[model samples]
Target: MTFKELIEQRAQEKNLLFVPMAHRFQEGKQVYRLGHVMLYLDRNVIFVFNGKTWVPTSLQSLLDMAG
Candidate 1:
């Protein structure tokens, strides 16, 4: 599976939300619910929302936390 698809699958397994960076904002508000994650394909990285900013994070780090 593709990286994006893998992320989506893992996120689902962990019950965490996954969203594309493009849809980050909607109606002037963040589209992702608080405590969710955003995928930035351009940078080929993932970021987690810390209630303020999108913080860069690694997939392994997230998986470690999930387990």
Candidate 2:
């Protein structure tokens, strides 16, 4: 499945929430190469590192973005 698909599936299965990250680089100034997709599943919400700091993005929002 595509990254979006995986995210959606996870959201459905676990009612996960996504938070986009704000920092694109690590402390070493090394750029992340995760291809605009990263997820941190917390008890209340999932954190998504979309090339930046963590920001909340809902499953519906993800679908909209994909489209």
Candidate 3:
């Protein structure tokens, strides 16, 4: 799903599992677990929580993997 769609789903769903992933990214930065989404300060990579676990991937890598 798209980012907007994902966000909407997250907002609507109250039972979605959320887990924290605090780590380094572009100096002193950490990742946040908001429902099913993981938002970061830097654009280097994205870590999405895929139900069972977290999916750590870059934008290009995700697109490449989809193809």
Pick by lDDT: which candidate is best?
A: 1
Best by TM-score: 1
Residue pairs in steric clash, candidate 1?
none
lDDT of 1 by residue, 1-67 (tens): 8866776687788777665445566334434331333334324565555557766678776555444
User: What C-alpha lDDT, on a 0 to 100 scale, does residue 63 get in candidate 2?
Assistant: 43
Sum up the clashes in candidate 1: 0
Residue ranges of candidate 3 with Cα displaced over 4 Å? 1-29, 33-36, 41-43, 57-67
For every candidate in turn, the CA RMSD to the true structure comes to 5.2, 9.1, 8.3
Q: What lDDT tens digits, residue by residue, belong to model 3 across residues 1-67? A: 7653453355446444434365634235565555435544334446554556556666444333323
TM-scores for candidates 1 onward, in order: 0.46, 0.36, 0.26
Worst 10 residues of 3 by lDDT: 58-67
Clash totals for all candidate models: 0, 13, 0
Candidate 2 per-residue lDDT, tens place, 8-32, comes to 5655565444434567443323222
